[model samples]
Target chain A: MSIILNHVNYIYGEDGPLAVKALDDVCLQIPDGQFVGIIGHTGSGKSTLVQHMNGLLRAASGHIYFNGEDIYDKDFQMKKLRSKVGLVFQYPEHQLFEIDVFSDVCFGPKNLGLDRREAELRAFDALRKVGMPAELYYQSPFELSGGQKRRAAIAGVLAMSPEVLILDEPTAGLDPKGRDEILRQIKELQVRTNMTILLVSHSMEDVAEYVDRIIVMNKGKVMYDDVPREVFSHYKELEKIGLAAPQVTYILHALKDRGFDVDVNATTTGEAVETVLGALGRKGTYI
Target chain B: MLRDITLGQYYQTESVIHRLDPRVKLGGTLLYIISLFLFRNFLGYGAAAVFLAAVIGLSHVPFKFIVKGMKAIVFLLLITVVFNLFLTPGTELVSVWKLTITVEGLRTAVTMAVRLTMLIIGSSLMTLTTTPNNLTDGMERMMRPLKVFKVPVHEVAMIMSIALRFIPILLEETDKIMKAQIARGADFETGNIVKRAKALVPLLVPLFISAFRRANDLAMAMEARCYRGGEGRTKMKPLVYEKRDRLGYLCIFVYLAVGITVGRLRF
Candidate 1:
């Protein structure tokens, strides 16, 4: 309903010896309000594919439709399209250079030709949305921890008021607490802003916990596309592609194979335990 | 776009030259350069040729790689050859298009071109065989006497090493920025010259910003790791000039005499 990539193929180093086909004829439709997670191994063209969403990567030969219009059309307003479909890069914190947090987040809105007042207002609003305090606005992002830098960078994109937000490996290399905080913030932002999210991640656990639908990529091709539950249900397929479902789901499958009636839909540990107790009561296997 | 840069250009090998003390290799290179230009007789040139050939053979670096390095300066090489041939007027041989080629001019052009080509190839061969760190270390060791003149020998070597280290990183960052701009419909190619130049601002601004950021981060990281300037800094592997180095210098000395003779030869 919103973005459509029809027959998109991506090639790196087109004229050089290092030429690689990062994506081949990738067709994906990201409708409005779909929280889609893209999972792929390293070098699986995840970055290249998401880059095409906002016209960051022009398909060597294919169509990228945004809001029912081809984004790459000769007459398309790409500047506006990019604002609508914002991409938060991997290690985006590395892009931070402005002296203070406020100026850094305000960068995108100002670049879009907003007046100082309006840009500052948007920056403050975005920072609040990302849970940064007004006091920290004057502090340098370099002084912030890894997670803060990441959130500040995200706020920079959010200041542009993009309807569709894409994050590439948003929680990579972060400690467990930082990872959890970022994931929680992402979920909160998605609901609070009613924004469509396209999260590209290598961690299957993150995909299972958050995304409504999952897309599996393996070596320049889409291996599977379905709801997270349906996609991860194919456990063998996931393992074959160097991925695994959520630990809880995997354990459920393991228990079922070992002569136990573990309800596989219990994707979380608590859900699995509760489901097991309820099943025992129904099956009269417990006193 | 910056990824196209072939940095370091070291030819990977397990040869004795690659394993030799960089200081010795550096000194050998200087002697070799001096020898290449010193020949004044046929016998001297012949001996130099033999000496250079032996070193090249011993280094075991491919000649094709040295030739490839010469390609970057094909225009400069041509300019030197043309300048010597056409500008240096002498006993006339053939005249065409308001330019006269003489027998002497041809000989001068050939010799100048060969000398320049040899200088480039031989130097590049050294670069291809030796790593940049080794080159800098060698320079620092050789320039140790310059410390007496307060020439900042250590500083120069340190700067060179750091520059060499960051060259590839900067190039990579530029490439990433270029790719990022291209994604935003910044047409880097297929535009008029003005538009092309204008398009470069987006690329340049981000690149400069990122480079400064990287430098700041690197400096901080260095401080964190307790890196002080050359003060009290000692080498992990101290260089020792062995008997092989003496033999190399001797061979190069004979070659220098030959190169001087070649310079004087009429044929």
Candidate 2:
């Protein structure tokens, strides 16, 4: 019911002098039906690690098992595995090529070996799930606005009905409203399907707000893997490692430093506000 | 995956070659190429070879890279060698299948092959030493006089500069599209001719679309930046034809003159 990695290591240009060990001794298991957020600085190997989950990249040394089966086994059907573990890359919309939005979404389902009618139906269902319009099905995807194009790209993958969805920087390069809309859709998709979701982002606030667990990486190794609040609680440690805590965590830390006895372990804005308000009242009754 | 592509791609080093007035380097490369073509005998080739070795040493780029660039024209060099070795007629060294190998012909073949190799290595030096942006800057400055001919020299240079800038961008786009197709089970490597041709559709479709989008965006960006085609414009770093450049040009002229003299004397 989960994807597990045992001693994963990814090397690029292996034999050449330009070879780089992008990931070193990374080991983790993403449980089924859990929302996991991967946060890392640039060159921290977050992107490389996720690419290995599917067969897009093979590990130099490690094993990735899906539901207790090795994905890279000799008898493994990589094509089917790819369909099951759909990856929507950064700026996934840039991968769109079909003349119409409908065909673009249908591309993945068709590749999954669905017949034309079945594929089209799945495409329509996925578009509806992403809240794309029915009338816009025949319109050119290139003519769509940035946010719609982004949604269409997600629908392109969703049409395959992936059991485990992994998105890399899905909300990158969007207006705040567009980012919220996309994250909302992803949340709804996870809820409706009970799928395991791994979201990779550099934005700590985004990860804190959405994901159930945080896996922070530093220089190709896992620095911390815990709940959002627990991870962000180590504000000084994270800052020293070229990372920032969520804004609420930052405010809470400053409040704790300046004689306010508040809980720094709370990451959510609501929880943070309650902690501060409760502290003020208790202190009011004291000397 | 596209990021792993290693094309030597102008590693940013603050060496003398990087600082040389692009015009000097550009003009120097042209003169060196002309001398390479003009060289007739072993002596002229020897002189040019020494000059090239000196420049390579000064540039501080690993000499191994020039060897890598030579791979592209290996076939052409082989063809030239074979044509001169077996096909040309003179003092017979041997005979093969209605073709004779002569002493002079062997000499011509070797010289021709060496000349071609040197030219490629020399030309690649500019690209290896100079980034595309600097190359275009040099080209525009060198062709500034073409304004009298009503040539779109500046525009052409700008286009060349942008084209170079986007080479990596387009390559990255191509790589992305290829991966996307591969994810869809588009087998590009092992397939029959028809199957391979059909497989290319998935990759090519996305590439062409992205290319067009990039072109459209570039046009808008250019217009927004107040880019007007070839009118009055000023250079931030005005190119001055320098002392070393003049000396370099003089050396090339002497080499070419000596090469022509060697041919005339038949020695």
Candidate 3:
């Protein structure tokens, strides 16, 4: 199953004097099991685009199709769509209100009409998948540290067992170690489940290292939609629109400019390191 | 969806009315509302209408924008008009199906409708023209005498401005929390009132928590900056009456005098 967008458009406050064209005519497709990262500056329509995938927002024009079914059709059930396409909003921890972490995780499955036993089972499985410790299951979500609360929040959505999981800035406001841990868990989850993942993020480095494909948004339009290497190759154009290629991309480019035989399109640190080592005639050699 | 609220919103513009002291605007709005109640005859209403039109024109805010606020009060307007139309005792003008339409009822209905509409528009004009900070500053200055009774005038104004500032922030927070819960397949729509209220638990808990966190953060930040509750504090942009404010006051008093005189005079 896949999601398809056909020339979607949205305008905020359409009739008011302060109307803003938040999303321009946009078309894209996401085949199942592909990890896609959406990156953009604030107000660049990244969040708006993701909200459209799950039917959280209605497009002012055009159509969205989920698994070949028109989501905007009169008989389409939005609630089912929401269950199938789990969206973990920015700061998802703030949505936790249950007395304990386990109950908070169970909220999603329970909302899907699962029996209590089944919901609890799914919640346990999801919590384990997110690596939430057993001791914290009965503890209040509010009492947990920031990273633990974020993990529990993610598990809440995971308990629904969505076919497509979209996270908007999940690592925001997290310390460096916390950000890496969350991203690693998300990467592991995608690998194990092979579910379609669309991560909306501002960090080019995180997107470059993890996502199979990158979609860059600018001023409500899709500026680039390709593999990370190919998208980061247009670093100059990206910079003009208030975004940049990953730090590794710039480093590799600077080395190439200084007459070093480096792959300037390398978007991640590992890839750039390998390229630099090979250029220095130290391929597969130990220090 | 909460964005529909237009109350307490200031319209940005550069115009004569917008430049006037907020105190003058506040006092003017009060006198204008009182004048709406004082007037009884067409002549008085006509003068008030002309004055309102002049102010609206001078303010440079579009007529449609001001009228948009009236939509919220349509139900109240309808109720008042209906009550005055059917319940007032007077000489009968016409009868239909045992329900008499009295001349006095018609007069009362018309005047009441006009009065209510004008009252809302006039009051909204003040808010639309003045920034919340300036309005509260003007209010604090005007109510300085109330400090004699230990009313904590400055603190009250400070609290009010902070509340005003948080309204938009809280609305945005609520919107985010609502969307997050909805994404979890929690249904907010298509439920009975009790079920709907229950659904709101997920949204409200986080909202309250975040609000408290924000309040704590603000309090700490204020204390860090040596904030001690408005005692011996100096204003950044102090309220002062200008030439135009004097003129604005003059126009308001003249309008009030005309409205009262025309209303009391025999036709």
Q: DockQ (Cα-based) per candidate? A: 0.13, 0.26, 0.70
RMSD of each: 6.1, 3.9, 2.0
| B7-37: candidate 2 lDDT, tens digit per residue | 4366445576767778777887887887776
lDDT by residue (tens digit), candidate 3, A38-138: 99999999999999999888999999999999999999989999999999988865589999999999999999999999999999999999999999999
Residue-by-residue lDDT tens digits, candidate 2, A176-283: 899888888888888888899999998897778778999999988999999998898787898887889988887887888998989988888889989998888878
Pick the DockQ winner.
3
Q: Which ten residues in a row have the lowest lDDT in candidate 1 chain A?
A: A89-98
Model 3 off-target regions past 4 Å? A282-287, B94-100
List the candidate 2 regions with Cα displacement exceeding 4 Å: A1-25, A57-81, A240-242, A254-262, A273-287, B1-8, B75-109, B190-198, B241-247, B250-265
Q: Per-model i-RMS in Å?
A: 5.2, 3.0, 1.5
Rank all candidate structures by their TM-score, best first, as comma-separated numbers. 3, 2, 1
What lDDT does the true structure give each of the candidates? 0.78, 0.82, 0.90
For residues A1-287, write the lDDT of model 1, one tens digit per residue.
Answer: 59998999988866443579999999999999888999999899999899888876678988888888888778998788878888887765345657788987877787677999998999999999988767788998778888888888788888889989998898988898888788888888898777999999998888677778899998889999998778878878888888888888877777778867768866656678887777677678975
Question: Residue by residue across B57-99, what tens digits does model 3's lDDT show?
Answer: 9999889888887888999999999888988889999888978
Q: Using Cα atoms with residue i matched to residue i, what is each candidate's TM-score against the true structure?
A: 0.70, 0.85, 0.95
